[model samples]
Target: MSYELSHLRELEAESIHIFREVASEFERPALMFSGGKDSIVMLRLAEKAFYPCKIPFPVLHVDTGHNFPEVIEFRDRRLAEVGARLIVGSVQERIDSGQLKEEPGANPSRNQLQTPVLLESIEEYEFDALFGGARRDEEKARAKERVYSFRDDFGQWDPKNQRPELWSLYNGRIRKGEHIRVFPISNWTELDIWQYIEAEKVEIPQIYYSHQREVVERDGMLIATGPFNTLGENEKAFTETVRYRTIGCMTVTGAVESDADTIDKVIAEVAGTRITERGATRADDRVSEAAMEDRKKEGYF
Candidate 1:
């Protein structure tokens, strides 16, 4: 009998292959960790890719300074558990040093400012390859990304000129001042991530599950009212049971009304949802029709 791999097994195999390729090809590489569900999944896959041995690379977190305390705590705890190194590039430090200017707006997320900080970190560490947890199904702009996304000297992504990856073959060729961003789980969907998380028993932040919090409705999104985000004169905050579809800077990442508190329940909820996770929660993406694409071109992860 011919044995075929299960859906999850096949995805895992592909990701492992990509990981091994990156390990062999790059001189220095780092995993871009955001302490979100997707990045946690990437860490799990990296662990599986090289078992009986520690992950060969360290994790890099570009701290926006507007991050949720819960997620940051989770990040440090998880990294400690795995005995991995974490290098944080502070956005606040950049602003304080006048290396980056903070944007003036009600939405004070350092989302855009993260790009330069991330690039600076990469350059400082001299990393030739970086692994991110971006999936094509998450956004329209991300849908255009190749498995091996190339960035130029200025760290700008040319989406239109991406190389082809036929037969699972990836080209990691780059010159001085250029690097590649690899995505092992680009083919996986939001539901697939939840399913894999359930099967793998991966520990994630509590914010992913449901909890009660004070939130204000803005642009049809439930923005949590806190230090990063506050209620306006016309806006009123109220307590509600909600959960983050995705995690990012607290000022821009919105939560959805949900009662799914467990992994299985969250899987069921994701299965029944039609809207993309980023579409439902990311206020920054709502800025324009091609906002993410524009950011990608300008080197935003």
Candidate 2:
């Protein structure tokens, strides 16, 4: 057979092209980095994309203040290694200032509260573009987004009003108050990301691998232990071997029991999994049918 680029190679090249285009075009841009696998992989691609020249943008983190320790540590270390500046958008600040009302319960997810903080941060920085490491195959709403998605001055996205972009040409045109949300690896699936992590030898958080953690079963998903959330009345927490499929605030995110200690194994696990990543772990998304879509309209990442 004739020579052809592997899917991983093709994805890497595509991300690199998009990164270069963003760097060349946008004046004030920021990356939404949550220290999750997707964001980690995106950072790695950026390093390769702008090799010789350091990354031209800073990473913005909308911290729910309920993140796993491993994830936060990994985030700090990775940013240090790449020498990229980090800007944190804290949900606690919003709560303390009475901007967002905290949910009253033993278990509460700050996922919904992050929208206002993220939008405020974007406005504070006057960012003309924001690069988010969101994948299409992860969720249904994401599938509807264009490569270069546009948001209005109010930070709302109208799916029906999306510009018609043909060929390789992405329309980044926007008004003064509006901005573009770029997803370089929009077409990549969960399996593809893990495969790339394996092939590229990128370092991810230790929680991705199987480990012992205090967990409780809630609505068919394993909710992992962390600060800022408590156990349910009938539901009791216990230690078990588990790993996070997707990483975010501990309140909203869940884990899966897998023996995937290495990247190769993780890729295999993802390839065989039946449920979508978000469907399995994201409690925020489980809130409503149009949750993610609604959040995107309200300036959530």
Candidate 3:
């Protein structure tokens, strides 16, 4: 008897193949983990990629110092469970050292500042290849990114000069001071991710589920009330049932009104949703039409 792989299994197999390829080809590589749903899924794939043997590469997180507390707690617990080494690049450290200047305003965002810190970390650790859980379906800029994206010596991405991937063959070649950003799940969609999570019983941060929280509406988005975000003079906080569609710096990542508290329910909601996750919740992306593209060119992961 012969059997064919399901679509999720095919995606899993391809990601595992990519993980093994990076481990074999790059002298030093790391997974860019943010304790978010996508990164958690990537970690699960990495675990399966090298089962019976510990994951060979360290996990890198560029700390914006404005992340949700629950996510951070979950990040530590999950890392410990998998026994993966953690390497953190502190944005606050850079700010203190005058390497990065914090944006001024009542609600300052460290999202844009993450690029320089991430680049600094890559340079500091001499990582040749970095795995990111960025899906093409999330944003327009990411949609144009290759599975194996090459960055120049300055850690800048030139979309016009990207290498062509023919027949699933990726070119991981990079010179000294340059590196490649690998997105193993580049083809997976939000619905696919939720489906995989449900099927595999993967654990994720609780913030992804619906819960009652204090939120204030700003520019037509629901901003969670927290230390990272302060209410404007005209803004007033109210209680609502909300869940995060995407996770990032707490200041800029918004929550959507929903009651999808379980994996199955979340999957159902994702399937019926028309707006992309990032477009719905990420305030930082709303800065301009090409915000993500601009950041990608500047080495933001």
Best by lDDT: 3
Cα lDDT tens digits, model 2, 194-213, are: 88888878999999998888
Question: Best candidate per TM-score, number?
Answer: 3
Candidate order, TM-score descending: 3, 1, 2
> For residues 93-207, could you state the per-residue lDDT of candidate 3 as single tens digits?
9899898999988888898889888998998999999999999988888888999999998889998888988877888988899999999999899888989999999999999
lDDT of 3 at 102: 93
Provide the clashing-pair count of each candidate structure: 0, 0, 0
Least accurate 10 contiguous residues by lDDT in model 3: 166-175
Model 3 whole-model lDDT (C-alpha atoms): 0.92
Error of 1 at 254 (Å): 0.9
For candidate 1, the per-residue lDDT at 104 reads: 83
Give the lDDT ranking, best first: 3, 1, 2
Question: 2 or 3: which has the higher TM-score?
Answer: 3
Candidate 2 residue 182 Cα shift, in angstroms, is 0.5
